[model samples]
Target: MLVHLLYASRAAHTMSGQDLVAILKQSREHNAGAGLTGLLCHSDGVFMQLLEGGRDAVNARYQRIASDPRHKDVILLSYAEIAEREFAGWTMGQVNLHRLNPGLVLKYSATSHLDPYSMSGRAMLSLFRELVSSGAIECS
Candidate 1:
């Protein structure tokens, strides 16, 4: 069965552009090899990721991410056995949430800023879909 997992985590330290690039490169390569697809959004040291793949693959990957030393406060926001993937265009697409229109963010989150901890999984997912529709995602 296929599954989709949504998660949020805080960076253990400040992140730089180079660091983000490295993470994306590694994620894209590994995910492609593992048959996973997803989108990742990072801003202000926070990371929000959506992974869709075979159940075991998704779960195993999530476990690894939750335990990875580079991440802190890793929270599994949502998970489900899905009939199909919501995001399949990129091995791991990237979104810069800070560049999003404030009004767009305000619709699903408080204060025009995304605090995944304060938002419902459904809301966060909705925002992610909107980002895709708005051409806000960057692919490498």
Candidate 2:
């Protein structure tokens, strides 16, 4: 089964553009090496990432992320089995809010939307797609 996990964490220090570039550089290498796929969106001091892979691969990635010192106050927002992968095109993509239009957030987080715990693959995809096109998330 394809596993999907969404998580958030607080940045330990100010995340400058250079800092993000360095992290994305490392994440791309790691995700490619592990044969994983994901999209990460950052906003309002929170890092929200969606990872998809085999159970073991996803779990292993989570383990490593949880121990990383750069990120603290880790929180698992949601996890579940999905019929389809939402971020299949990404090896480890990142979207920072600095360049993003906050309107996307307002749209996705609309009251008519599914609750975070009950969000569907399509909903998640829409969210990621918005971030992807917003130019807010760039590759290092």
Q: Could you give candidate 2's per-residue lDDT for residues 22-124 as a string of tens digits?
A: 7777777888887788887655455767888887889889988889997898877768887887677778877655665646655766654224334444565
Considering only N, C-alpha and C atoms within 3 Å, which residue pairs clash in candidate 2?
95-137
Off by over 4 Å in 2: 96-99, 110-126, 132-140
- Candidate 2 lDDT (Cα, whole model)? 0.72
User: How many residue pairs clash in model 2?
Assistant: 1
RMSD in angstroms between candidate 1 and the native structure over all alpha carbons: 0.9
- lDDT scores for all predictions? 0.92, 0.72
Candidate 1 deviant stretches above 4 angstroms? none
Q: Local error of candidate 2 at 95, Å? A: 1.9
C-alpha positional error of residue 90 in candidate 2 after TM-score superposition, expressed in Å: 1.1
Per-candidate TM equals 0.97, 0.75
